[model samples]
Target: MSLSVWVPIVGLLTLGALFALFSVGIAPIVGPKRFNRAKLEAYECGIEPSPQPVGGGRFPIKFYLTAMLFIIFDIEIIFLFPWAVHFDALGLFGFVEMVLFIGMVSIAYAYEWRRGGLDWD
Candidate 1:
């Protein structure tokens, strides 16, 4: 491989780095400095902040369960994209393996559904 081929890639990387640095460096000076009680407080998806327990209270298990479900499905998609793109090359073996993988994922989905893990209320 010739070092000349890497010139554009290195140039693009340096340009990206400079752009990110410039945006962050200029933000404080350009952005509003106004701070109020509401602005300073931690915000949650437009819901009013609840009072904290005198001692830090335990978080609801549902919150963790929902987060876990998101991660599980998100990882499933990551695997699926590569398999789909290579479908022609992988042929029958890949098809069977993906079917089995999807079957397992479906079982987990069904189990969560039965357990009310998907419910918001």
Candidate 2:
């Protein structure tokens, strides 16, 4: 390729690096430095600062199951987008590939359903 193409590519990469560096650099300088006992306490995995509720309020498994389903479907949609955009050019081969992909997802969905993973109660 010509210097013209390489120059712009290099300039863009340099600009992107500078932008990211400046963003991170400015945050520490401008952001608050306040810290307390609550802030220092580990949130998720560490010991709970508060007492547990009555019945030890259990978290429903359905929440995680639904989130997993959303992630799987979201990924399926992402892959389908490019295939959809080039459907005309890809023709039968792309169509078959997409069908297979959908079939696999469907099988997974069926398995989840059969295993009671989709149940709410």
Best by TM-score: 1
Query: Considering summed lDDT, which 10 consecutive residues are worst modelled in model 2?
Result: 45-54
Q: Which ten residues in a row have the lowest lDDT in candidate 1?
A: 52-61
Which runs in model 2 stand beyond 4 Å of their true positions? 45-71, 113-121
Candidate 1 wrong stretches, greater than 4 Å = 43-56
Q: Which tens-of-lDDT digit does each residue in 34-117 have in candidate 2?
A: 989889975743336456742377655565667778877898989999998999999899999899999998987887677677
* Global lDDT scores for all candidate models: 0.84, 0.80
The global Cα lDDT (0 to 1) of model 2 is 0.80
Give lDDT tens digits, candidate 1, residues 26-113.
Answer: 9999999999998889875434577874236656667667777887699789989999999999999999999999998888788777
Question: Candidate 2, residue 43: CA error in Å?
Answer: 3.9
